[model samples]
Target: MEELLAQIERALRIGLTVVVAYLVALWLASIWWTFRDIRGRTTDIFLQIAATLLVAVFSFPGLLIYVILRPPKTLAQLYEESLEEEAFLQGIQVHNSCPVCKQRVEGDFIFCPWCQTRLKRTCVRCDRPLMLRWKMCPFCAQAVYTPGSGEAQPQVAGGQTSAIPQLRGADPEDTGPGTRPQIAARR
Candidate 1:
C-alpha cells in the first residue's frame, strides 16, 4: 500500500508542473501581444512599456482593457483625413465669389459674367482693372475716377453718351470679350 501511495504522489507532481508551465507560457504570450499591439497604435515609448507591463501583470484581463482603450483609427487613416481637410480649407481661402449673383469669378474679372454687375472699374493712367473701393491704382500709383463719382461723360453724334463701361485690355484700343450693352449713336 505504501508503494502505491508513493507512485500516486509522483504522478500528481508531474501533472502540477505541466499545468504551471502552460500558464506561464500563456502569460508570456499575453505580454508579447500587448507590446506589439501598443507599438502599432502609438508612437510614445512610455505608453508601449506601460501597456506591456500591465498585460504581463494582469494577463488576459489587461489585454481586454488595452483593446477597448486603443485608438479607433490607424495611422494611415488619420493622415488621409488630415490631407482632405487641408485641401478643402485652401479652396475656400483662395477663391473669390460674386456678391450680386454668388457665382465664383476670377481675381482679375472686371464684371460678373452671370449678373453683368460691374465688379471693378478701369484705372485712369495704368488702364488696369481696379478694385471697387480703392482710391489709387495698384499698378501705376495713379489716382482713379470711379464710374458713379459724377465724372464728365463724352457725348457722341447727338447728346447721348456711352453709358456702358468699356473693358480695356493691355492697350486702351483693345476691347476684350464682354457683355457690355453699347448703343450705336446715329451719325
Candidate 2:
C-alpha cells in the first residue's frame, strides 16, 4: 500500500513538470509575439523592448495589457494612408502660375498681377478668357485676332475658323485633300 502511494505521487509530479514547461514555452512565445508586433507598429526600439519585457514579466496578462495599449495601425498602414491622402489632395488641387513673373496666380486671371503681363485674351464672341497662343476660341469657335497683326483668320463652314494655315497665294476654292487653300494669316 505504501508503494502504490509512492507511485501515484511520482506520476502526479511528472505531469505537473510537463504542464509547467508548456506554460513557460507559451509565456516565451507571447513575449516574442509582443516584440515582433511592436517592431512592426513602431520604429522606436525602446517601445519594442518595453513591450517584450512587459509580456515576459507578467506573461499572458501583460500581453493583454500591451494589446490594449498598442498603436491601432501599423507603420506601413500609416504611411500608406498618408500617401493616399496626398494623392487625393493633388488630384483635387489645381496648380496655376504666372508665366511672366513665375508667381502663383488664379486660373481665371487674364493678366499677371505681379508683372502686368497679358496672360490671356478675352474671346470676342463668347466673352470668355482665352490663352494668347490659341488661334481659335474653343468655346465660341471664333477666330481670335492678334492685337497688332494686319491679317484675319479665314472663316470655314459654320462660322468656325480653319485650323489649317493657308499658303501666301493659294486659292480659297482649292480646299481639298490634295490641294492646299490660301487665305490671309491671322496673327
Candidate that would win on TM-score:
2
Q: State residue 80's C-alpha deviation in candidate 2, in Å.
A: 1.7
User: Candidate 2: worst 10 consecutive residues by lDDT?
Assistant: 149-158
Misplaced by over 4 Å in model 1 are 76-187
TM-score of each: 0.43, 0.49
Q: What is the C-alpha RMSD of each candidate to the true structure, in Å?
A: 15.5, 15.7
lDDT of each: 0.64, 0.68
Question: Compared with the true structure, what per-residue lDDT tens digits does model 2 show for residues 101-172?
Answer: 567777667767897766666665466877666766777555555554312321221133223324311543
RMSD of 2: 15.7
Error of 2 at 155 (Å): 26
| lDDT by residue for model 1 (104-186), tens | 88777777888776666666545577667676567765444445433233123112212222333344333222212221233
